[model samples]
Target: MAFQSKQSMTEPRDRTGAVQGIEGVLLANRDRIVRFLEVRGAGDGAEDLFQDLWMRLTDRRSGPIADPLPYIMRAANNLMLDRYRSARQRELRDKAWGEASATHAPSSETSLISREQLALVETAIAATGERPARIFRCFRVDGLSQRDIASKMGVSLSTVEADLRKVYAALAVIRRQFDAS
Candidate 1:
């Protein structure tokens, strides 16, 4: 029998019976995998998932899988699910922490300083002018977006942005004076 090439024997083969490295197979199918992930609701995270797949494939040593496409797709799906679960857990943990912290009252000195700071901020916003003060209240107190403020006030978006900027500048000056004192 003729001597078989060592390279041919050692190289991984796909379901098609063609010899290819796992990396080569994965690289060739990268675009298809990303598209699959996007369809599965990964959106802009498709590329990131693909990179994770690449790392997983490269990091492990295993025998040639008869069909890697399905395997890869499964891995991507699992990774996406893991990320979603992790994000949900993190959000819950943060909410719980925030609630815990909110229950604690500040020290008397801290409360007094906070009240004084609020008074200074209010004074600074009032000094800026009526339009700026209203815009500042709409944003900071009402938590309205700039676009909402502009639309509600029948002003250009730029006007709203400018008002906010003026308010912010005045506040910065007040803050600097307070820090100096």
Candidate 2:
């Protein structure tokens, strides 16, 4: 469904008194609801979650909530929690698939190609010099940030960047060799 901007989703109000329904209360506090989602670590998905919240409220046949604000907030929180749980479940499932794949043997041709690629990469890294090789491993394999790599290596940020560039250049040469072969 199309999501409206906060300004476009006008507050639910009749002329008589307080906004009565959950949908009305949510429309009135859309910005605040989004903020609540953000605070709960929805991050970039906060707007989508807010829209989902709106849809759920509209689709359900609920009576007017006496305290719509708190009710809406609780609903938003529950939505975020559900999203988080679903994401986590997805991650675990993917991880399981990956682990299972690691136990399988490749075909002879695939195995040969993988070994050749690994040898080429090792050779390239070695030819790039010790400092650059170490820096590349630290950043890529160890998952260290550039700043962290520099700090750990007792080198300047520029040095870490330069080393990474050198590693990239070496890899390019290796790639060319592979293409020629």
Candidate 3:
């Protein structure tokens, strides 16, 4: 989106021009900001931080900036750093709390349960032996299309289709188990 200058640079009113100039950068850099956060630290909260940055930028209480682009970028960077520190502090505090409140059951018991369920699934797939299992995993779990899987596995498209049938059967059994549960 184009950043329309609401007023001249010399205007005495709110620095609407300055803020509007930065709006384009903000819009274009959203994905870049998210990727930066996802890679550097705030993988889970990148979107939240992005929203917060916009809120801070748009807040009327901040008044007009002399040069809004650099100011907003600096603000975003500072916010990300603050988020990283806060997350680390929270993690440390949670760890200490867990140690103090230790019980017979660990906090990761649910994760263990899920892992066990996944292992059961693997075992079930193992009953189909290696090739079909690999094909099923490549096409399903890895999200490859049948044609792509066939090309990668050096197999015919028909073979890929056949393997998909086995995958469907296995998944139907798994779905039935889930439904029964």
- What is candidate 1's lDDT per residue for 1-181, written digit by digit as tens? 0122233356444423332455777888888989988888789978987888788866665445556667667777887777776665565456547778765333323122356788888988999999989999999999998999999999999999999999999988987786565
In candidate 2 the C-alpha lDDT for residue 58 amounts to 66
The TM-score obtained by model 1 is 0.42
lDDT of each residue in 1-181, candidate 3, tens digit only:
0122333334436556546646667787778767765665667977887888888776644334555555666777778876665665566457657778654233433231246667877887777768788988887789888888898989999988887788678866975784354
**Strongest candidate by TM-score:** 2
Local accuracy by lDDT, each model = 0.74, 0.74, 0.68
Error of 1 at 77 (Å): 0.7
For residues 1-181, could you state the per-residue lDDT of candidate 2 as single tens digits?
A: 0122232245423312332355567878989999999999988888998889888766654433556677778888888877776665565456547778764333223122347688889888988999999999998898899999999999999999999999999888887776465
Q: Assess every candidate by TM-score.
A: 0.42, 0.43, 0.38
Clashing pairs in 1: none
Ranking by lDDT: 2, 1, 3
Model 1 misplacement above 4 A = 1-20, 101-181
Model 2 steric clash total: 0
